[model samples]
Target: MNTRPIAAGLFDEGASPRLRGGRHRQTGRFVFPCPQGGERDSYDEVRLASTGTLWSWTIQRFRPKSPPYTGPEAFEPFALGYVALAGQTIVEARLTGMAFDAIRIGMALRLTTLPFATDPDGTTVLIYAFEPDGDRAS
Candidate 1:
């Protein structure tokens, strides 16, 4: 089966995947998934850091409303969090590879991807996420 990122220009699929972010040309502020259309002109496209510290998190116990929630019909709870990319910006992403209770603020995390859903054509769509970084965690 073929695989693809959930959205174009969202992240790279190289040996080390990185989220595609944008740096404001004036303030140097960073934003994820890069801006589109006219807003694209004022920023420089950059790959985001692969590692970060978990800033905050919460458990998503119920299936989110549709139109945006495209997961499986049989809903399951999930963990989502904001990860601070050091001097860069904090990014909101799903947390994985650990139990919800194990997640901690300031815990080291690494960029990763998870299978979101399969397209009608059978292509597995992947979404960006953050996972515990065993090597860097205290």
Candidate 2:
């Protein structure tokens, strides 16, 4: 099946994916997605760390309102959280590859992807996510 990212410039398509972030040319601060349009001129595109620590997270139990939520009609709970990429910014993303109870703050995590949706043309749309770095199944 053909596969594609949910959005362009979000992450690199590689053996081990890395999020594409932006570093401020002047301030040296980083942002998850490199800005667009004229604002992009002030930032330099940079690949972010592939691993991070789970800072905080919560279970999304309810189906989110539409117009944005494009998942299956049948809803399922999922975990999401902010991962601190060392000296870089904390990124909010879906947490996967483990059970909810097994999740813990400061747990080591690594960049990954999950199937978000499929287009009529049969293209699988993938979204970036974070999962436990090593085996911690419980």
Candidate 3:
């Protein structure tokens, strides 16, 4: 099956998975990757750091509101957190690999893709996440 991102420009489609962002020409400020300037009013494509530290997190014991969620059924607890990318944007993503109880602040993490679900056309939709780089994503 072909692997595809949940959304285009979410991560690098290259050999290594690094978050993609845009650097504004006007202020050198960064924005989440996209065409014609992503989040920023104007920008140039830039590759973001893959390694980062867990800044903060929480165990999501309940399912989120619908519409934009489309979350899992039966709602198993999952950990979500912000990863501080040095000298760049801090991304908020789902934390995986380690158990929810084991998630700790300041833990080393690396960019990795997680399988979300398959589309009607049979393509696999993937989501990005920060997993413990201790070994799994190392």
Which candidate leads the pack in TM-score?
1
TM-scores of the candidates are: 0.96, 0.94, 0.84
User: What lDDT score belongs to each candidate, Candidate 1 first?
Assistant: 0.91, 0.91, 0.79
Indicate the residue-level lDDT of 71 in model 3: 52
Which candidate order results from sorting by TM-score in descending order? 1, 2, 3
Q: Model 1, residue 39: what's the lDDT?
A: 98
Off by over 4 Å in 2: 135-138
* Candidate 3 local distance difference test against the native: 0.79
Clashing pairs in 2: none
lDDT by residue (tens digit), candidate 1, 59-135: 99998999788887888899999999988899999999999888889999999888888888889999889998989
Q: After superposition, how far is residue 6 of candidate 2 from its true place, in Å?
A: 0.6
CA shift of 67, model 1, Å: 1.1
